[model samples]
Target: MLRLLTRFIGLLLLAGGFIALIVDGTRSIAGGRLLVTTLNKGASEFFPALYQGLQNGVSEKSAFLWDPVFTTLLLLPISVAFGGLGALLIVLSHKQETTPRYWRR
Candidate 1:
């Protein structure tokens, strides 16, 4: 029963992570132009020092890192982690499909 519950929760996490990824992806795509603008605005609001440095002539490449593209990319790992952890739990709860070679001998 514990195993069954674990597997159910794992499946839910996996589904939820994937769903979140899809939604985030769509949002990033839809707000393409607003991506950098929003990130800059957010940074100004939350991390003024970082925003100040960015405004002080940071490299274009470096500036882009603070944009929505990077933000979306950053979320990939979080979603993947959720799915990976859920898969791990599901695998841990399941019985081995094959007997160990040492046991057979």
Candidate 2:
């Protein structure tokens, strides 16, 4: 049950990432330049208050974490971040077969 749920969520995130990629590609083509939407920009646009709170919370915990780690993560392309995370979750949740079909009796 949990595995199914995880895969479902992962599929949703992957779809979202694909949609974002398409939008970014369209914008870049129209503007005649390479353009990418960073995770920070997308998060802030969608959830301004939550994003601000996350920044504040991280900053309060550790300046180094906020400046280097968090900022670096936030700077990743939104599509990459979401797609990578979704892919990871899907892979992690996958069931492994112990026996090969050819070896089965």
Candidate 3:
């Protein structure tokens, strides 16, 4: 029963981690492209002060926080770790089957 429980939890976590990874990866890629395109298009439309600030790279630091790729990358390690831990638990939960000496002919 304990083994089953462990296996179940392991499977759940493994699946969840994989799903998160895939979703985050896709979102990150799409978001990065969109951000670049938008920034380029909006560059000329910005007010003089804002345009100068952008040219001076003032928003670079804060922009990183808003980047989906960076956010997703941050979550990647956690997802990978959870998946690895779940796999380990699943392996440990496996039982070694054996037969009694009396049953061996």
Q: Which candidate gets the maximum TM-score versus the true structure?
A: 2
| Superposed Cα deviation of residue 76, candidate 2 (Å) | 0.8
lDDT of candidate 3 over 1-105, digit per residue (tens): 999999999998898668756765776798884222123333345566766675456347676554564334334354575688789989999987676577665
> TM-score for every candidate vs. truth?
0.49, 0.91, 0.49
**Candidate 1: which stretches are off by over 4 Å?**
33-77, 97-105
Give the alpha carbon lDDT tens digit for every residue of 1-105 in model 2. Answer: 999999999998898889989999999999999999999999999999999999999899898999989889999998998899899889988999988898586
lDDT of 2 at 15: 89
Q: What's the lDDT of the predicted structure labeled candidate 3? A: 0.64
Looking at model 3, the pairs that clash are none
Candidate 1 at 53: error in angstroms? 31
lDDT of each: 0.66, 0.92, 0.64
**Stretches of candidate 2 exceeding 4 Å from the true structure:** 101-105
